[model samples]
Target: MIKFNYPDGSHCYRALHTAHAVFRNDDGKLIARAEKADRTGMYEFEITGFELLSTGIVYD
Candidate 1:
């Protein structure tokens, strides 16, 4: 099990099951990748083309 916190105070968890397949990138390099969650629970996903929100500061 792998866990991490996002910038929006949400948590994300991923189970490393097995390498589904190996695909080649644009440079023809083999890359090992696995399938993500099955979308059964609440998960935080970071959008690529979005601006960050300024929600004050988070102090741990």
Candidate 2:
């Protein structure tokens, strides 16, 4: 899973996928995407409509 922090400090998530993961809305339009930066649990996120507040790994 992918953990997401919203602009208002709220949190949400999406299914974890490859580096080129895509976050789309119900209309099949793109919302955001992610790329793994390194092994340090950091990732680069590109989002639309809402601000990309923050991101981190979810250790199971």
Candidate 3:
């Protein structure tokens, strides 16, 4: 797994079951990661409740 810091200066992690996050929404409410196979495949994310939000990537 990899680590990343959000726009709000908060920290979060990439989903082990999914791919590493490569893109995120402006409001930090959504995320989009690269696929393990092609690194350009589709990514899915669902934001709910008080889950951590991400706007951009800080590190890999």
Candidate 4:
């Protein structure tokens, strides 16, 4: 699971392993993008509009 929080306190995620996060809406359309931060536990998120709403998601 890809997990990280944006600077604005919003969060985005995906189920695939990649260098960047590609956020999609409920309709599965592209909405936002962010790259993994050089620092751990953070993401440089821009183009907001996505947030993970599911509960019980954990980092592997």
User: Which one wins on TM-score?
Assistant: 2
Task: Report the lDDT tens digits of candidate 4 across residue range 1-60.
Answer: 444555476665654443355566676555444444443543533443444445686543
Candidate 3's error at 10, in angstroms? 0.3
Query: What's model 4's lDDT at 16?
Result: 40
Compared with the true structure, all predictions reach lDDT values of 0.40, 0.49, 0.50, 0.49
Per-residue lDDT, model 2, residue 23, is 77
Q: Which candidate is the best by lDDT?
A: 3
By TM-score, is 2 or 3 better? 2
**Model 3 weakest 10-residue run by lDDT:** 45-54
Better of 1 and 4 by lDDT: 4
Better of 3 and 4 by lDDT: 3
- Residues 1-60, candidate 2: write the lDDT tens digits: 555555455655554553344476676554555544454553544344332223573343
lDDT at 17, model 1: 45
State model 3's lDDT: 0.50
Cα lDDT tens digits for candidate 3, 17-57: 45545444777665545455556566555333123435584
Q: In model 4, which residue pairs have backbone atoms overlapping below 3 Å?
A: none
| Candidate 1 stretches greater than 4 Å from native | 18-34, 38-60
Q: Candidate 1 on 1-60: residue-level lDDT in tens?
A: 434344466644345443243345576544444454664443223321222233464433
> Measured by TM-score, how close is model 2 to the native structure?
0.31
